[model samples]
Target: MTPLAIAEHAPLFIVLNPASGRGEADNARRSIESACAQAGREHHIYQVDRHRRLQPCVQEAVERAKAVQGVVVAAGGDGTINAVAQATLGSGCAFGVLPQGTFNYFSRTHGIPTDTDEAMRVLLNEQPRAVQVGQVNDRVFLVNASLGLYAQLLEDREAYKAQFGRRRWVALWSALLTALRGHRPWYLHLSWHGVQRDIRTKTLFVANNALQLHQVGLPEADAPEQGQLAAIALKPLSTLSMLGLLVSGARGRLGEADSVVSFPFESMTVRPMRGHRRVKVATDGEIGWCAMPLEFRVSPEPLWLVRPAVAPELEATRQ
Candidate 1:
């Protein structure tokens, strides 16, 4: 398929979350409209409201975009991107992002500029490229997924974001508070690489984004680029020990921590050994419950992302 360009005739179906962009949905909408108009691109904007309308909105956009061979764009944070990506998967519609969140990991990693105007321009001028995706059960995650303490930390972070604000410092502070509080270990049975073991852990995190892993100092940061998922498990720890582990992660030396178990794999099965049939899981910062045992793996198909062409040097390294 030809790449979408500024002079292209295909339409763009934009899914915008009003809660994102620091509640400046109007600004995002205007920027999108202005860009599309200047480019003479046909486009449709679907606003995702607070009534939990993201799924239906995205589905509608996906169907429309698919019919016209247009792009389905996500103009929000990670949660919004995940929602749109989930619907666009297998729809044969290229996905675009207009990063409007505290952390734009997916957009930044893929070279989708966080600036709304710049992102819109890229959407109009880029081709769809297949990118790695991680899955937990049936849900697709573009960044990471986890349960146990990490999952709890996500929930706590959201609460903190609501009370304090939605900023990086706020998120970091919330994580510190969550980690400083003692957490109960999760007794889980893990099966991976033809091996099965039972372990007590504070968290079991599976990463699909190499940039995030590298930022957190995990040695298996290259797992995603190698077509595999990276798993990080935290052993049960004292409060101070947990604090130390957090520091290690912040310092990009998490793999060097004794309490950390890091590995790369194509698949892993985790079951609650404590008779719990359901567990809270966080995917791309969204908290939800999934039935045990949880299955984490790389998706068989990639998410067709709309971004700038990869540099020849980077492409060579990937090959």
Candidate 2:
């Protein structure tokens, strides 16, 4: 049951997302191949094209990998990892991450190496660890699931990035500003762990574990643990106050924002009071716009991950 024990018995299945991070899959594949050659380890690589194709690919990979230790390595961004995790959940297949993406939030959280060579080394040398994953409506996400203005911003950023190359921060900032100006509060009805609460919020974030935004202070103790979900709702604020809160959040001092409300829950539902445009949703870094109401929940069991050794140490500390 321990990480060390799991590492000794798992085989590696490297799944690469060819479209991730401006087409870095070829380079990553080379690195992985080189690493496997050097390490003299048995492995297989599966490159995924369309997003919808990930589920079937992962499912088949899981079945194939089950014979050789049941480990699946996601070689793209968080989106690739999320897709693979959804397939491997409860299948006894451990997941690994290569972190070739823009944000690489999951890698940062788990302390995976950023350097390609170093990441490959870690992949060959690391142990299989048990980490928590969030499940919403039978969907699995390893990092966090969120809604509100930020999700809308992600939508804009993704579109802009496709057309404008890598330097698209300006477009993202502009989209964020636009979202702030047009943002409106919506009523959220949530019930969890035998408690019920209502709130009007402009943004809702549900993380699988505490998230430290930009190295700012981490979430509070109320942050959901593995197999639990932590919910944070940003109450509507004046444009000025919201800007201030945004600045504070950027500085990782979100506790200073009076408009922020946070709690831990197992399940919850969010709905708009009146029919409006569909709400945007994001799990990890993938974005989609969905109509209200949205249902979110946590899986009963923890997902297995083949993470760097530092992941357990990082998880032990509350930042």
RMSD of each: 3.0, 3.3
Q: What lDDT tens digits, residue by residue, belong to model 2 across residues 6-124? A: 55535578778887765777778888888787777778878787554776777778888876665777877678878887777788767778887776767767778766778777767
lDDT tens string, model 1, 25-54?
A: 888899999998998888999898766488
What's the TM for model 2? 0.85
Question: Which stretches of model 1 miss by more than 4 angstroms?
Answer: 1-7, 50-52, 311-319
Candidate 1: C-alpha RMSD to true structure equals 3.0
Best by lDDT: 1
Overall lDDT per candidate, in order of appearance: 0.85, 0.70
